[model samples]
Target: MLVRTGGPLAAVDPSEFTRTMARVPTPVTVVTTVDAAGRPWGFTASSFSSLSMDPPLVLVCPAKTASCHPAFVAADRFLVNVLSATQSDIAGRFARSGQDKFGDGDMVPSEEGLPGLAGAVARIACTLREVLDGGDHSILVGHVTSASVSGLDPLVYHDRRFTRPEPTPSLTTAG
Candidate 1:
């Protein structure tokens, strides 16, 4: 069944929009960069995706109100550490504000001199390419300089909870 209202689209309720988006599954990642004083700053983000392959570009959205937003926007380089299923704790820690999120011993300095998590499923070192306005968030476009991946299941977020993908079942043919 379809209902036709020919005028204009109505604005969605913010709570409803958030609840709806919460149902969508997204990979968890911790985006990290070094501050001017060489201190590490990080925040958990799910709004990350590969934008292009020709120049090897990726984008991550950080809210304008985030405490580390200024550091990220001013940084020349950053690293995106794609969390593994075992990294839910790391995700939660970074998701919070006004704390030393890197107190845990899970981080190491990457070749690019940025913070990289040890058990991440993937790590992408990138140089800041562009910053675009995305409503209340900033779209950070990064030109990947180096990247690596591990054969681990990615941490996923859906319905406002952390989850992992179920393994696919094997199929057998009947003779």
Candidate 2:
């Protein structure tokens, strides 16, 4: 049975919308960039995706209030470090507001000259392409210049919790 009773669909409640979106799984990554003074800045982001292949483009969303937002917006290059399932602590450290996120000293200079986490599942170095307004966050598009990936599972976020994806079973045939 179906019923139609409204001229337009009602707007979704913000909290309910958030709750619904939380069920969708996303990869956790740390977006890093160096400031003009040569200081490293970074933040954890679950909103990242590949947009193009011919141009090798990717995008990440950083909130306006993020501590490293200004630096990332002004920088010419940045690195997206795809976290491994074992790196939840690193993700938590970068997610905080006013703390020494890099104080633990597990970073090395990436090929792009930005700080990269030591044990990431993958690293993508990119040059800034564009910045677009995205309400409370900014959409940053980058042209990937260099990238590397390790044979490891990535960290994931779903329902406001950290989780790891299960590997699919391989097909085998008995001779």
lDDT of 1 by residue, 12-103 (tens): 99999999999999999999999989989999999999999999999999999999999999999999999999999999999999788988
**Tens digits of per-residue lDDT for model 2, 1-175:** 8988869888899999999999999999999999999999999999999999999999999999987899989989999999999999999999998999889988888868889977999999999999999989999999999999998889999999999998889989988
Lowest summed lDDT across 10 adjacent residues in model 2 is found at: 105-114
- Please list all clashing residue pairs in model 2, or write none if there are none: none
Model 1 weakest 10-residue run by lDDT: 102-111
Query: What does candidate 1 score in Cα RMSD to the true structure?
Result: 4.3
Model 1 quality (TM-score): 0.90
Among these predicted structures, which one has the highest lDDT?
A: 1
